[model samples]
Target: MRRPSGRVMVGAAVVTVVLLVAAAGGAAWWRWDTQRQPRVDDVVTDMNTAVADAVAAAGEDAAVAVSPVVAAADCRLGPLRPGKIFTGKADLYTDPGGEDALITTIERNLPPRYAAGRGTAVAGVRPLQADIGTVTLSVRRLSPGWLAVTARSRCSLGAATEPAAPTGAAPGITAVTQLLAAAGTRPAGITEQRLRCTTGDIVTISAVSERTDTGDLTDRLAPALPSTARRFTTGDANRISYRDGPVSVIVASSDDGTAITAQHTTGC
Candidate 1:
């Protein structure tokens, strides 16, 4: 059989190039599609819910602290996007269970719509990654005895929206007010988020503030806490936290690593 002419071969090459470009365009669209919510607030809110569910699956024995829905929401998109990307994070420490073992448990416990992802191992610890659409929940070890579970969303199209302020008196409001007063400097702004946990407890992450100095902040602010408040030490985080009933006040380094920040959480 005779081989095709050079002109025919070039024609075939052009068609292949066109098909490749179309396929590439389609893949990019899929990467940016809104698989779930259409706004940044809604994206982080759903992520918070997923993190809360993972927390419950982690069981009551683990010492859990969650990121503010807005703080862990650090990802940004273009001005005209319809969705946003962010990671809902939780630091789990003081659990007797093996880290990988616990992650496996969480993998099994998330809603079944989440199929397992290609388990990638970082530092020999493979994250328990499960995905539903572009949203994923991943658990991995951060350090010795400290594990972090993150629910991350894809970069889709969305506009950024600040969460609405609490309408009623949250349980931790008084404590937050007192702490802010002791900080002695007015915050630039704050984000108060309330995430509903599957366990029926409303996790109110409130009174988040802009950056301030770390210079003995806890000592200056210790007097403001109620007598019921007692401390819990999280290793090397350069912060202080207290538990009073359902209320927790945490003063940690700001996201920029420039200054201290005070925030509160009401619920586990």
Candidate 2:
């Protein structure tokens, strides 16, 4: 048999090398794709496991401390549908008078990761727990009288650390001032008559004889007011209260029942 020419031999070697490289590349791509595509069943299983673990950790207690956060790498906003809310692990220490305190704490301490608008309120509440770091308690209000609450506990991956020491600093006054500015611009039946500010960021506003016509007041004030503010009936037939942020403005018809009287809180 005649030996193949050097050119032919070289060409053969090149073809073999190209085939080997292509095979290796294809294998790598296949491995990457398989690793990237999380198995649906596996994900479902993990979620179920997490939920079960959270419930088990909470035990029979209505409230338990759990981590509000889960694996950061896998963190997701899951199915938080409109008219619904979600709260991760929380510890329920005591039942407050109402959901207002809880809402305020959440707003001040753990603001939402995303806020579509400044005054937009969460439509509903949904709470959950994590088996592993921060305990969280959460609640959502559906309507004036309807609410849902949940609590859970979580664990941090690191070793136990000392609890953070509490600070005695007074609450910031700016919060109240900002709240007042927002309340003043409301379009309710009463308009701002006078406003006073004190050293501690306290604000007091008095509103006088505006109008008795509910239709006009609602038309103007309701549109401008934040969604968190609402009109609710009171014992007095011709009186109503507008609550926005931390301030509650009481509006009552004047003795003559033709004008409205509004009084805002001190240092709201």
Highest lDDT model number:
1
In the range 75-145, model 2's lDDT, one tens digit per residue, is 22223211112222222221323334444444343323312112235443222212222233334553442
- Give the lDDT of residue 208 in candidate 1: 50
lDDT of each: 0.63, 0.36
Against the hidden reference, what TM-scores do the models get? 0.59, 0.23
Model 1: lDDT of residue 256: 74
Clashing pairs in 1: 81-157, 81-158, 82-157, 82-158, 83-157, 83-158
Error (Å) of candidate 2 at residue 9 is: 99
| Model 2's TM-score against the true structure | 0.23
Q: Write the per-residue lDDT of candidate 1 for residues 1-268, one digit (tens) a residue.
A: 9999999999999999999999999888766664533455556666877787777676633445666543344344555443346677776653233567667767666676766553777656567777766467877788644688788877644544466666676655655556666776545545566567755664544455555565666567767767876565555555566666555567656667655566666564
TM-score: which candidate is best?
A: 1
- lDDT (Cα) of model 1: 0.63
